[model samples]
Target: MCTAPGSRAFLEVGGRHYRRCEHCHCTFVRPDQRPSAEAELAEYRRHHNDAQDPGYRRHLAQLATPLLQRLPPAQSGLDYGCGPGPALAGMLREAGHAVALYDPFFQPDAGALAQRYDFITCTEVAEHFHHPADEFLRLNRLLRPGGWLGLMTRFQTDDARFAQWHYRRDPTHVVFYREATLRWLAEHHGWACEIPAPNVALMYKPVL
Candidate 1:
């Protein structure tokens, strides 16, 4: 029995299978078969998303567009999983939000976790999580009440084409989540969720 990082759902991949957890329903990749943190980091570095292209920015904006309008000026934010260049953090700062940058590989600063924030962004980072439950719970712990957690990732769809999907072609991607999964997460975590885009979601923890 393997508990997925976020949910307790049973998972079977590459001939490896795991029992589901009743509490979280997270489907996890087995330890022996799962990718290691070191192997995962090496593959993340191979992403060439730093190129400042209008098209690329627009592609990224697909994730940030709705957020640009929703986030208030000067609200604190964390650009979680900002790859080597920290582009999303720069964009949030340019938009006048006080943004802090952190990445397990690029900007792993001990102090980044010291304070809470009003918002957080994780673009193209969820799929690489080795233990999403622990990782996502950390994000939850870091977020202040009413803070927003934005994520950019392709939602899993049940289709024969997924195997051939370019997004999954990268060896780095391991975990898969669907739109319902995001919804499930928000409900379970007490956050209001919005999926304005197919690849983006905004979850807000209510100030109770």
Candidate 2:
């Protein structure tokens, strides 16, 4: 009953019950098992996410490199779910792209959500989606024609490894995506999808 019928497949990982979607191949924590909003926000606040961190910049560069290559100069972008530090937005700005920041707990700039962008970056953020389908639609609507959406998250490989996957151990990370799941999302929204790097995907919305 998550997102739609035929989307939830139940399983037990380390005695924790999880659900996998046949439609999109996204694994998810059960609603009751999810952490409280305050707890989730507190965890986010604990992240260093420092703009000056070389290692963190390199991690963001994984998505930024490809996305920058595809975009023309002076393009505007939104760093969706840009947590407390919002280093990604600063990186994009440093490259001369006009960037906006939005995070439910951090930036909380609702007006940013009301605007469209030439591209949107959701790096390391998709798994936090409570309503993946709805959030996807919102991102789609936020993009200008022929815009792109860049995402970076670990893709679910298979059932066996999923049991021991370190990414799943995070309480805030609920929905999980497979490569096929990203493809399905692209097809669902009539966008072009490409994997420019490992654990990174770029989805392009066609111009009218």
Q: How high is the lDDT of residue 53 in model 1?
A: 59
TM-score of 1: 0.85
After superposition on all CA atoms, what RMSD does each candidate show versus the true structure? 3.3, 1.5
Q: Predict model 1's lDDT versus the native.
A: 0.75
Error of 1 at 199 (Å): 1.2
TM-score of each: 0.85, 0.95
| lDDT tens readout by residue for model 1, 1-37 | 1243344435454565433344443334455666677
Q: Can you give the lDDT of residue 94 in candidate 1? A: 76
Tens digits of per-residue lDDT for model 2 on 1-208? Answer: 1365665556777667798777677788887887789999888877657888999999999999999999999999999999878888888999999999998888889999999999999988999988788898899999999999999999888788777789988878888888998999898999999998889999999987
- C-alpha lDDT (0 to 100) for residue 206 of candidate 2: 99
